[model samples]
Target: MSDLRTELSTNLDEAAWEWLIPHVQRDAVIVVASDLDLLDVGVAIASDNISSVQQWIDQQLMVKPSNTQVGNWNSDRTKKFHTLILQPYVLVQEMAA
Candidate 1:
């Protein structure tokens, strides 16, 4: 887990860093799930401000394609290569808690 955290922090591009730092500081869990040809970095913001989350996602897409992949993987090696698409949505239940 620590290694994965380090890799994410180190490999994230400038745009990612800029968008992620504040969320991270606010205790959001940022998960980077990937598939064969797409990387979906979801930010679980614990807030009701859905617009803010969407804006952040839009900013990231402006810098690069939202469906961009981080690396190449052989399809044969895995059954399904579907990753969690980075959709910034407010987890209302979690937020209420």
Candidate 2:
């Protein structure tokens, strides 16, 4: 866990919506549920724990941001989200208000 944590920690970052536009443009953004540990999810995906990721996806806990969500973010240029990259997908979780 330490090594994986170290590797993932380096990739963990906070990003504004504008910085993520490229990923969104490519339809590579995934919105992770707030209840889940963002790092844990990254670790799971990084380690290829497909069953865990599949379960989350099946339950709709992980998904692409809805149009409403994108609309809101588009309107608020200053908003930021916790983000992580897992190859083709970039996982994002909304920050607690």
Candidate 3:
């Protein structure tokens, strides 16, 4: 695996990360969320340059046709967010506890 894949795999579950690695950019930020009911999952990929990320979402993930230009105030002023919905799972935790 490449360095980016290795780093992301540490942050994400193995199966999910493997599926996502090919579509994610080297410097993008990945956020994985599972709902309280544990029946839904959401993944967001953010980056300053999001063309590749947007392409993946359009072609592979098949998000509904709409504006992709949703902005974020809490994140870096220059970057943006792309999201995907999926099944439930935990994303982050203390790795060596």
Candidate 4:
């Protein structure tokens, strides 16, 4: 767990920490995912509610094109939604002051 904590601390940015600081509970495992396709496992989002995440995945997976463009961005830029998997790692939130 120390190794994961160290890794998260080293990798996570201020904004990421800000989001988790309030929601995560110290000594508890937290699953996290992103659109960058980590560990060759695609992308995922961390949340305590697995059912809701699964439902979101189910609804999003139904898209035929897979990738969709939303909002303003470069013409070549596109976004692809990925699946959410239960991560094996656990995250223990740091205590707030």
Candidate 5:
């Protein structure tokens, strides 16, 4: 396995760090894909500071409801309510190297 390191500097709280760290570490590719009009906004928000990203994520998660049910309703309903958003950052180093 390849080990990747990403450092995020933001004003986000410790809780946000707990949530985001694992996702960033597991992601193989980070893609910034959004509409042109939203590009500037996205980049600006993403680059502003770590706190900004954390706040955005927290807000998104707040509005979204989690689906823990398992059954026929699990797949379809779960997909409709899920959201994963993040800013793309360059891979700075590989610890396994």
Candidate 6:
């Protein structure tokens, strides 16, 4: 719905890697690919678009940060990401420099 989309868009935020560490620790973070729009993904998830969500996951376009990635981000606290929290999950896409 447009209302949901607008709401999600407003909730989108830029967060430093350090700020996101807690979510990562809770295993609540899902990474969206840079090529995709974070809002679109958030809408799909919030609306229960299972097919599309599963398709992205099957393609590895959406995934939780791996230990190596977590480590890298941890080492560089300055890294930033676009984030949208959809309860139980924090959708993240690394911001393009």
lDDT of each: 0.30, 0.90, 0.30, 0.31, 0.30, 0.93
Per-residue lDDT for 1-97 in model 2, tens only?
7799788888889999899888888999999999999899999888889999999999999999888999999998888999988788899998865
CA displacement after TM-score superposition, residue 93 of candidate 2 (Å): 0.6
Every model's TM-score: 0.22, 0.91, 0.25, 0.22, 0.22, 0.96
How much does each candidate deviate from the true structure in C-alpha RMSD?
15.2, 1.2, 13.7, 14.2, 13.6, 0.8
Q: Candidate 5: which stretches are off by over 4 Å?
A: 1-37, 61-97
Off-target runs (Cα >4 Å) in candidate 3 are: 14-49, 60-97
Model 5 whole-model lDDT (C-alpha atoms): 0.30
Query: Which 10-residue span in candidate 5 carries the lowest summed lDDT?
Result: 1-10
Report the number of the highest-lDDT candidate.
6
- Could you give candidate 6's per-residue lDDT for residues 1-97 as a string of tens digits? 9999999888899999988999999999999999988999999999999999999999999998999999888888899999998889999998765
TM-score of 5: 0.22
Q: Alpha-carbon error at 24 in model 4, in Å?
A: 25
lDDT of 3 at 86: 30
Regions of candidate 1 where Cα sits further than 4 Å from its true position: 1-44, 61-97
Query: Of 5 and 6, which scores higher on lDDT?
Result: 6
- As for TM-score, the candidate ahead, 1 or 4, is 1
- Candidate of highest TM-score: 6
lDDT by residue for model 5 (1-97), tens: 0111122222211222223334445652122222222233234454565675465455542122223322323344322211124344321111111
Superposed Cα RMSD, model 3 = 13.7
Whole-model lDDT, candidate 1?
A: 0.30
Worst 10 residues of 3 by lDDT: 33-42
